[model samples]
Target: MSVEPKMPKCWRKESKPHKFCPGCGHGLALKALGMAIDELGIQDKVVFGCDIGCSLLAWDFFDVDIVQTHHGRTTPVITGLKRANPDLIGIAYMGDGGGYAIGSQHLVNAATRNEKITAILVNNTNYGMTGGQMAPTTLPNQKTETSPYGRSIEETGYPTQGPEMVAAIARDEAYAARGTVANMRQLKGFFKKALQNQIDGNGFSFVEVLSTCPTNWRTDAKGTWKYLEEEMTKFFKVGEFKTPAAKGEQS
Candidate 1:
């Protein structure tokens, strides 16, 4: 007898055939998020907040309550909502541009404040939604719509390591980790741990998902996976930056 695959109840079955581009990593990230919610049995308590950009398309992907915020405002909105309702699990989903460039300050403030929230920062290097512009996390020499001749390190500077930055300001109760969609199991584990941190009332939890934008990156499916594993992984190393377990307590 063959066993059927289990689907996450948190996902809206009607929302099948998501709008994400072919080989896009957004779907993987969403799947991981949904799985985490189901595993933690917090499907009813998750209040997802998605920022403008490609990430905003996830507004209706889940069966749980969701709010779509303007560009660079996802973090603050989720933070406020979580503060108002302490029993809810607030989640902020954002793209590289929304999380690292326009909303960089908000993200830093939220992490430093140790707000009871879980942030999923999807870093695909360039801005995937708006014609492949150079994002704050865009790698040096990477060619984008804005950086036609390849990004200049001296002029554009280096990519921002979001997880490391958040970890630097996070307290012992907080959690920070970096995982890539290239490693599906590890990525889901990171998502689950991040959600658990918030559910445990341990303060803030930040997870950076190194994803891919095949359409914008001008690559096919295989190339996308190769790029994520070879190029992107070199700059944004994956691993947990901080965990509650490090403080002699279970995470």
Candidate 2:
């Protein structure tokens, strides 16, 4: 007899053998999120919204209701849902391009307003769905279809520090963290906390996950792990940047 792989109860079994490319990190990120939802027992109250990039592939990844939005619009859509029905646990999922580039304004405004929603952004460094174009989070020396000669820092500037930005702008009750797919347990912990923050009626919550895209990266298994565990961590610095203060403590 063969032992079956354990999956999150909120995950759709029919969607098993997901559509993400081999070695893609979105699956791992989503798995962690699914586990968080299962542990929190808020599957019914969760309203998931995914952006138009590779993140859109997760439209049916979960058994919960999901809204697929245009590129960079997931944040506003989720914000609207949460505002209309404060009981809903709104989660906006998107890629770096969607969150940092096209959707950056929505992200910034939401953080400034301290919207009661959780935003999960997967930073793979490139526009994976759009033929590996250089994105806002692409490293300085990284090369992509649009940056074939390697990204120039002088022209492009550094990668977007997403968690840092969110933590700096969001109110004291907000939560911000940077997690990686290499560490599933830690990533899931961050996801759970972010969701719990929303459940507690806290302000905006954001988690940026460093993920892998071997197909767009043109890397083998060894290279993929090297980039994800070693290279990416150097710049991303996975950790919680900010969290809600204790009950009676100063923020």
Angstrom error of the Cα, residue 50, model 2: value is 0.4
The candidate 1 region of ten consecutive residues with least summed lDDT is 242-251
lDDT of each: 0.90, 0.95
Give the winner by lDDT.
Answer: 2
All candidates: CA RMSD in angstroms?
2.3, 0.8
TM-score, predicted candidate 2 vs. hidden true structure: 0.98
Top TM-score prediction, candidate number: 2
Show where candidate 2 strays beyond 4 Å: none
Write the residue-wise lDDT of candidate 1 on 76-107 in tens digits. 99999999999999999999899888999999
Q: Write the per-residue lDDT of candidate 2 for residues 65-103, one digit (tens) a residue.
A: 999999999999999999999999999999999999999
Give every collision pair in model 2. none
lDDT of 2: 0.95
TM-score of every prediction relative to native = 0.95, 0.98
Which runs of model 1 end up more than 4 angstroms from their true locations? 1-6, 246-251
